[model samples]
Target: MIDQLLDRPITDFIPQREPMVMIDKIITCEGNTITTSFLVKSDNQFLSGNRFSESGMLENIAQTAAAKVGYECLKNNEPVPLGFIGSINKVGVVDYALVEQVITTEVIIQREVLNVTIIKGTCMLGDKDLATCEMKIILDLG
Candidate 1:
């Protein structure tokens, strides 16, 4: 599974595609944490005037969490399930990302109950904080 993932883009692991796929690669996925990266570009769906919007930051964090789930599922020979952002709370956007900048996202799973996962996500550009939020992800287990 790692070999397959290594040869494909992040879109292969998550449901998002094309301009909507904010995360470019999975940096690490172990224990209860996941780290991912995305390069902000002019053609990104959430870009406005060469700047990555808050929505993109949120989605990137969510996708980072999703990437971890997807990787584990695939590694275990299970199908990748669909997931949705059920809720977001205590969101803090500290800065904006510009085109050509790479944003790194890290998410730690705080809790899981049935099909719902609660996570604390943070996005950064180098050492500068970009966004942070606590969100609930609802997985479609059917």
Candidate 2:
């Protein structure tokens, strides 16, 4: 069963813990593309009014990319490294995601050189765009 292959929780893929771990699950992962989802809940740490703050949006994007990298490591039987968003550019928030809504995030790896990877990410709530950004992630391979 597919569940047998990906039985580990999303928390296993990223470094963040409760209150900071925003991504709920990894929906798909193929090559340079990864898709993850998060349910915007009333008890979420970033919830403001009915939605998440702009910082929360950016973290979601970064973590999506982190999930991709983590998945790759798991597949290769390597240790999952710590990574941080070194830079973010061209960020735009088109709409606010509300509580009780599920936000799907997708990230495509643009390029990687040495220990840095550049990615383009987008967050969507159904057909509406919530946010998009290009980020550079610095990986700690040690």
Candidate 3:
């Protein structure tokens, strides 16, 4: 069952085709809570000095949230809408994602208010959390 879930890549969900998709794999997903991983490379245009900044970490979380939205929509045969970060809250950078490290991120959808979905997520390099944020993502029709 889990194998079938991760079978399709994140590209099938979100519209990011190239040089933009940040997530590499879905480690585990259960509706509102999803865990994913990304391989950060020096070649990635978004990375600086083989490291992803705190803002980038937030972006990564937002993209991961979109992935969850896409998965649900596809499973229900509905359209996945384009989404944006509505607001940021309690964001902290404990460290930075280094080169050649596959950063794993986990996001939990806490609530939906005023058409915005609230998400709390964390980025980790191994067991150490590199960053964490509570964000609100706004959905817009594509």
Candidate 4:
């Protein structure tokens, strides 16, 4: 089931549309961990000069988490729920990705209660860490 979902267009699993969409593909979704990949384009909204900004990396992490929820909802034949970033904590930015670079982000679910989920996300460029943060997402199922 998981293999069939891999490499598909990122829009299928994430509610974000073009321009605002930060992730390009879902690399893996298993258990409490989800990974995604995004190519930093020259015209990306979050780009400043040739570098992808910290805010963009943060959005990528959140979108990766959303993909996990969207993937599970798809598997259960449910509609994709809208989600918002409630808060962010412990943010650390070591570097920024340049244009044409591919960013790999990994999100680990920390907890889920009702419509709220807590996760830790780390963004990487190859083996180099770019940024990491713990985010709380609130889902709207209504």
Candidate 5:
């Protein structure tokens, strides 16, 4: 089942639609960590002068985390909950990804309490780090 889910479109595991979907595919979701890949397209909204913006990197991270939750929910035959970014901390932008470059993001679940989940996300371009941050996501259970 997990292997089948990996072959499905990223949209099935995330709430964002076209143009707003930051991730292209889910590489893996194991234990408390999830990894995703995104290609920096020329027409991407988060592009800034042929480079992916910091905001884009951040969104990619958040979406990676969302994919994790969504995948789990689907596997368990449960509805995927809507979630929002509660806060972001310790953000570091090492460099921006150029257009056509593939950005890989990895998000690890740091903690989860009730409806709130804390995750640490890191974006990488091959061997170089692009951006990283810790984010708090609040799920709407009601």
Candidate 6:
């Protein structure tokens, strides 16, 4: 419901667990572009559990893209369509972001063929960009 969008961020919506929740809030979403934010806390399970390393910043960018799609479908419409991540490729992490830093990630849809959505994303902490990647996400309802 639209109610969920205001009270809590997308990361807390649905059932994505602690470490897997990769987004904070939707910054800008219109047409085929969406921006979101995330803060990596020292208490994050990934940082604390050793499952995620500093070099995994690209993955965070990809996940932020996922969060954007979910938010777009959830808050902008009635039925709340569901989408899934198909692939993420050509990733590079710039090595500036560290653990417990807030990042602003943006996703722009570059290609959309059929139901597949291909997007380019960048993760930035304030004005500093730390990672970039192109992700192919499979969004289908079936």
Worst 10 residues of 2 by lDDT: 1-10
Full-model lDDT, candidate 4: 0.93
**Candidate 6 Cα outliers beyond 4 Å, as residue runs:** 1-8, 11-15, 48-56
Question: Which is the better candidate, 3 or 6, if ranked by TM-score?
Answer: 3
- List where candidate 1 sits over 4 angstroms from the true fold: 1-7
State candidate 6's TM-score. Answer: 0.75
RMSD of 5: 1.1
- The sequence of per-residue lDDT tens digits that candidate 2 reaches over residues 38-120 is 99889987877888878888999999999998899898888899998899999999888888889999999999999999999
Q: Write the per-residue lDDT of candidate 4 for residues 66-133, one digit (tens) a residue.
A: 99999888878899899999999999999999999999999999999999999999999999999999
List TM-scores for all candidates, in order: 0.93, 0.95, 0.91, 0.96, 0.97, 0.75
Q: Per-residue alpha-carbon lDDT of model 3 for 63-105, expressed as tens digits?
A: 8888888888888889888888889899888899887888999
lDDT value, residue 59 of candidate 1: 90
Q: What lDDT does candidate 2 reach at residue 19? A: 82
Q: List the residue pairs that clash in candidate 1.
A: none
lDDT of 3 at 50: 69
Q: Which 10 consecutive residues of model 3 have the lowest summed lDDT?
A: 1-10
lDDT of 1 by residue, 1-142 (tens): 4555544578768998776788989888888998898888888888878889999899999999999889888778899899999999999998899999999999999999999999999999998889999999999998
Instruction: Please write out the lDDT profile of model 5 over residues 30-56, one tens digit for every residue.
Output: 999999999999999998999999999
What candidate 4 gets wrong by more than 4 Å, as runs, is none
Q: Count the backbone clashes (under 3 Å) in each candidate.
A: 0, 0, 0, 0, 0, 1
